[model samples]
Target: MAAIVPVPVVDDLTSPGAQQSRPGLRASQSRRLNAFRYLVFALAAVFFGLPMFALFRMSLLGSRPGTYSFAAWKQIGTYPGLLGSIELSLEISVITFVLMILLLLPTMMWTRLRVPRFGRTLEFLCLLPLAIPAIVLVVGWAPEYNRIERFNLSGIMLIWAYVILVLPYTYRALSAGLNAIDVPTLSEAARSLGASWATVMTRIIAPNMWQAILNAALLSMSLTLGEFTVAYILGYNTFSVKLVSISRNSNNPVVVFAASAAGLLFTFLLLLILSYVGRRRRRRRA
Candidate 1:
């Protein structure tokens, strides 16, 4: 009678046999890490998606007899002032975004090139907005906005106010992009090649910092679209103000739910597209 016995293979650290197992061990570790990453991603998706699902369900609520429906969603068009509010929000967002780029890009580049020391001062001023509450800023501008009404300009003040609100974010984005490149060197090279300051900024500097520019513009647009306090205090019927007004007056959650869901969807898509484009640009550069 014979019994079969197992023997362990002890790998010596300096042995070629041990080196052969290294690849297998590393591969196993990689697989485990990837599995953990996927698990975390799935959990995060659920964490963020659950509320959106609940909101969507609410948007479709009261549509039928114990049946889920989207009648409320369709009624978004019928909602009073809904379309006008959306249009005003879009107008402010677009105008503010344009002003952010035009007003900031040149000044940022000029500061970096002409007076490097003032760069910190500029950044400090930009961060000041974060320190001041939006309500306080709105209150301070109340008198000026009142005067704006005398001129019949109305909500146009919102565009300028939004530029101030969006400064902190857009400045940081532009500063990060500027810090990545040598501004003085780029400017000198462009000038030596017969480029005007305008040409240098528009063609040379802007192209290099396109990502920052895009980020700033999109961030400005996002902020403008979601703005409320200033618009409300100043008596402008921007989208967010209208949403709150409707929710307060109608006491119907459906319109609120529908608008929120639509806004969330739009924001998500905008961010997703930006992320994809940035990744593709990085890949192309690499």
Candidate 2:
């Protein structure tokens, strides 16, 4: 008689601790936080979601000016450059996402995996914008954004500003992703396996934190999309500016409400997808 058993192949990249600490909230914390967290989330739901709800209602019912109809959304679809503006804004956000990954990937590996000095300094540099007043940033960039001599006064300025403003949040999301992975062990093993630094980073590191990357990218995209002050200051009137302008016009109030509702709905859907991704990542690890 013989018994058959499957043999598991071990990759040197996995630390014993890696499987032990897959980043979903621990059960004890979940038990403690479930009610409190749900309460907090409910309050946040009321706070952020209510205004958008009002906007939707305003679009549909306010003024009885027939403004509450889906007509506004239809009209928005017909506007010249409207779709282009949305596409262009997305391009900028995606660019920012790529640039951030370029900057973050190595820095995180160096800090957590390679144990490099000055990593904290760079991290601090990335986080510096957190303290800068939005108004001040707008003021600082106002003149530069509209430069005639530099030949750079265009959509790029908008992209750069959104990217800059969103850097802190993006960095934290990605760095937390890094913290959740077995950076040192995986990287060292990859090195041992004759994988180059680039391969190790692109393959080993990124795939591990796909959820975090999604979260960061989505967060950056939403932030950039909704950013108002920078667009106003930069004179780069994209969707947000146009929305603001529409809101300002008493006659187009319905259009404003429709736009706000569409925007909120889109953001919430994107966040839901991100949450699903995080949950999936945890399940796969388990």
Candidate 3:
């Protein structure tokens, strides 16, 4: 029997003309995608940048028409309790961040390591606050504040409420971080090496999750600083509460706008810093 030789097959789609058109087709698609990306970026810039510009411009407006001054900005410190409210808000932000990290980090790590099955339930509980309206939360917290006031804690009591409000954001950030790393493997490795739980958490897990921790801290602090409803309902003079009070009581509208712009700028700076740090961390990891 004669063995027949196999014939080479060529796909029409891969013919010379088809091959020549493919690069042009890909180039066109690339151009369209880049254009779409630019369009999206422009829209985002307009959406976020416009309000911030208006706010800052309003803050700079002068008493007379067609004039501008920094008088309002200068007078931000003069408003009664303004500085104190800012200080109080900062304190609350710091305390709330610390408490949130201490309470949630350990619990989340343990749950992920020991009871992976309960992760969904744990996430649900953390995110439950997002479904609860701020006003409703305030109503529920009012009674608790009454008891807190008896101890003469004043504005400091807002820390607890702010922590609750920040939970959903903090949890999402931390959960993402935990998922990014092999928590169970790391924990087990550390344990096998005779490292205590404290050392494992601090020296091993915490370092790996720094980005997520920073994100959680930023969210907690920003929420604490900007929160109004709970603090107002609880009769605390937080930064946001004081901003409202100043807007209502002060004749100078620019002053209120100035304070608002300052707060917005500060939050923006925090975000910028977070972005910078995140970039640095990624570079280092790479």
Backbone collisions counted per model: 0, 2, 0
* TM-scores, all models, native as reference: 0.84, 0.76, 0.85
Ranking by lDDT: 3, 1, 2
Candidate 2 residue-wise lDDT at 81: 56
Residue 51 accuracy (lDDT) in model 2: 77
Question: Which RMSD does model 2 reach against the true structure?
Answer: 11.0
Expressed as tens digits, the lDDT of each residue in 41-144 for candidate 2 is: 99999998887777777767634654445676775676655666667666777787777777766777767655668778868877877777577777877776
Q: Is candidate 1 or candidate 3 better by TM-score?
A: 3
Which 10 consecutive positions of candidate 1 have the poorest summed lDDT?
A: 1-10
Model number with the top TM-score: 3
lDDT of 3 by residue, 88-154 (tens): 9899999999998999999898787778888889889888887886788889888988887888776
Q: For model 1, what is the C-alpha lDDT against the true structure?
A: 0.79
Backbone clash pairs for candidate 1 read none
